[model samples]
Target: MSYAVTARAALFTLATALTLSPPAQAAVSADCTESSITLPPGALYPNGIARAADGTLYVGLITSGNVLRKRPGKAWETFFPGADTVFASNALRLDERRGLLWGNSPDFLSGGKARANRIYALNVADGTLNRSLALPAGEMGNDIVLGADGTVYVTETRGGGILRLRPGETAFSTLYRDPQLAAPSGLGAAGIVLLDDRLMAVANFGTGKLYTLSYNDPKPQLTEMQLPRLIENPDGMGLAPDGALIVLENGILSGQGRILRIPSPKAAGMHQLEVLREGMESPVNLTITPQGCAFVSESRIRHRLLPGHETEVPDSFRLYQLPLPLTAAQ
Candidate 1:
């Protein structure tokens, strides 16, 4: 099947499952203690999560384009109401310095009628739409990472490349493109994190491969990183406090979602991949706090992706918090 056909099929299946399913309240996992927060009622498929410095959280929903916000001890509020223009919010990153919250809002979840993808910048203070950039037709904006020099980089899941929006630029330009970045399963780059000014780590959701992009030179270099073992659908990624790579494996199809910590990803052969936690329910994205806790958004996509498992759809999704000890740096 062609990439477009396969993608449409997968999306159609998910939509059918969701239509057949009825939401029910489910118990939290034993590992999810007081730190985990339940998503607001009626929120489904929480795909992206970003944390503010003041103990506030911003979450983007996949089915609805709504961006929800939660303060330290306050009820959840709709930061950005969902609209037809902003269809699905996949990944989010908070640019606190610039007072913007960047997110990828694709139309894939809008009944599989894929249209132009969108990357939006919202005012962090009041959740007003600051700017919205439309990607070319047939491109799916999946994940986002902001550069130190005010550049915005987004992963094209269907286009199998990276798109860049430089400072003072009105439109995005192709930063890098390669056929190998995509998998036969139709999904391509899903997660990305800036290592420094020039380096970025990206995860391939369909192939479960990891790669590093060096964009210092005129021609950017994309090098696949050899891993200790095959990762099961790597989804979202972030940098730890001590500069280690922290990855979330969605494992929605395999039913083995987990989080991993790679102490030295550049030197993969020398360092072992530590499994921090396992058995999560389709964790799609994560954001690390300054105090060393990782907050993961459990998307629970399996309930909507698997036909027979639709009844398992939970009434409320959750955000899990796992403390990463400083000793993990070693």
Candidate 2:
């Protein structure tokens, strides 16, 4: 169905139930990690997930119109929503210092001349609503990333481009506006150590293509990575400390959803491996910690640990997690 329809259902169905729960607490494995915590009853189907410098998980729900956070050993908290000063939170990003959490407003949820999608900067320490950045209205804010120097890059859905916002600037300029990013969806910046050079990759939600920028050349060159046909709608992306690239299939057309792992995007005989997990209904974003923790968020569920796939997630939607590989890059 269309985004609006799904959102309406999400808002109405929210708070009616917990939706999903872990199979157990001590389980460990890519397919069996139990959930440490489940999202609130009203949280919408979550999409993009970003971790704060403090290490809390920030998940954006496209329908429920809020960004939910889960602290280590604590229950999930819904911080910002469309009802507040700004708008509904969609895509997510973090400051270079990991101090702030930013979520995109993706206009698909709210129709208006209102500032398209906005990123609400959240304080990880207190779960307080901080500042917000606004983009031109009607442009769907997809995924976002911060450069080493702290420049912020956000992708636009139908705008078919990426916008660059400096550390303290409000107005954003398109970094790359070609059709290749026709549906510029998910985005993540790789540390120089991860890809030999600081790079940023954006997934095309519509084209099933991968776009990469080598470095900060005035004009960023784009490269494409081929994927297995099974992963047609590439949504979000994550990188482990060792540089392994983890991709999430963001669409829910065929069945529910799927998560795929590619050893490395550096191209060294690496093949796509499908990660078997349940409750993936529609996996949006993923974050791999240096400690071997793979945190994933479904369109609706809160953040959970890897091997969290076995948790009892609703067939309609859910999230999963697994232990990241120690030698993920080599």
Candidate 3:
């Protein structure tokens, strides 16, 4: 090859690297001072976040939006492209054992008006949409999590409670249903970590409480715990490495959303937990890295949907990285 060809090739390689490198890693990871959620083509209120085994972050851009995936130390990538193919309620979970992601099909936004509001699965390796699961009565399925045994548990908020779907079973059965659960939006299950075995937790945005239930044996009991403060719209949930639960509260009434931490996830019968950060704007989605860095996705849509008058969110998409001290808290 000539010198000119080699020079052009070198320049092309450098450009590629720059595009893939994280904004902070460009010079320093700590240099990430500007926090923003870069919305994809159709992501207005993008929700649902899951981290793969390889540290890649997969987010649900619900309301017929694309599923956005961001590999660690890199910019976001649009692996799947289909409007509302991934539904509402930010239901996205990386099935660690099965190596697939389960997302909800809840319809809350205007874009998701015609959606079926079901559950779908995708292979992490190829981003191919595989294994679609429909909801029962399809009462707008929302958040979901997988048990250690590969059993898929989802929160059917509009349907009133949690639904459990075992492996190879297409249908589901009601695990817990109560009027106390106003809106069971986000869910996380502790299989091996909790002594109660299938320790499932759900976030109720309407009530601002984190309700936990245990499947010790034949019967399951439901318990509700209020939030530290009046956090509006507690949307997505992510479990930190140190076993603490990280909640992304969308402050709709207060016009703010914040990342809150609840220590002692296994400990039950608690009134409320604590909030680590405050004054966030519509933080709808959250994902925890292996290193315990909490990445929150903020969408200022709530501020726009005001009474009589309305405007689109003009803020750039943001993802804040918070170094949570979960281990030290423990």
Candidate 4:
């Protein structure tokens, strides 16, 4: 399911039950000034964000279908040819080794009007389209990640599975699918990241739990991750230098977001939960830079769409550089 649909449903259910109020200002990271570069004017609903090894930042617009780029200390500019193949850019991941920027375009809001869900690869050097592959009709391509061996994996938000495109392939095939990943109403299997070459950590937005899968086996083993506290709507994730998992959580039905740093998979089910930041509006994506800094997109799109919560967001959205205590693992 899409965040737009999820917010509308929650609005209908909780509009009468929960009191809606203006969002409290979140704390900016003290380590670094909460300094941020604004997206290009009209680049509404910024969703997915990724940073290249060269300190360039790329942001995807969910509504306008535009991808914006900014270099350190520079203003944001429209990337590439501008929404030629991108319909609804949701998640972006950079394959630095190959100089490619991968994005998932799912028509959650513009369904029927927009094109089908697609996985697009663009050359970061010149912002030229490299490859575009359409998924099966009706599949929602929500998030993307690259494997250590150059394999590409994408999350099917509604299909409850992962789609894979090997290094030299132009088409994607179902890598894994199971009922456990299916959501009752909203999204299931929202975010995914490779813990290593063999193991993958996935977030189930519908159920609010994490699962670990070993992709090396023909039929991989999938197990629920036992965390000290469950992450509600875990959308995007990254790894820390010490192997901890950093998760971006959209609050449970309230659009209040948070960032969590949890113990490494070696500790697995029982590990301390570290709250890196909280009180974000609707953080959807997360990325770590080469210098070990963490950045997040405060989309706030869901909060604005929810009925009573429309007045809670600001005139514009923002991207925050978090003051994480750890660095990206070498």
Candidate 1 per-residue lDDT over residues 223-262, each given as its tens digit: 8887756566788899876677888877755667887887
Q: For candidate 2, what is the lDDT? A: 0.56
Which prediction has the highest TM-score against the true structure? Answer: 1
- Score every model by TM-score: 0.87, 0.73, 0.76, 0.86
Measured on C-alpha atoms, candidate 4 has an lDDT of: 0.72
Report every candidate's CA lDDT: 0.75, 0.56, 0.58, 0.72
**TM-score, model 1 to reference:** 0.87
Tally clashing residue pairs in candidate 1: 0
Q: List the residue pairs that clash in candidate 1.
A: none
1 or 4: which has the higher lDDT? Answer: 1
User: Candidate 4 — worst ten consecutive residues by lDDT sum?
Assistant: 12-21
Q: Which candidate, 2 or 4, has the higher lDDT?
A: 4
lDDT of model 2, residue 145: 64
Which model scores highest in lDDT?
1
lDDT (Cα, 0-100) at 145 in candidate 1: 87
Provide the lowest-lDDT 10-residue window in model 2: 7-16
Q: After superposition, how far is residue 62 of candidate 1 from its true place, in Å?
A: 0.8
Give residue 14's lDDT in candidate 2 (0 to 100): 15
- How many clashes (backbone atoms < 3 Å, residues ≥3 apart in a chain or on different chains) does model 4 have? 1
Candidate 3 wrong stretches, greater than 4 Å: 1-42, 72-75, 83-89, 111-113, 183-196, 226-230, 268-272
Q: How many angstroms is residue 329 displaced in model 3 relative to the true structure, after the best TM-score fit?
A: 7.0
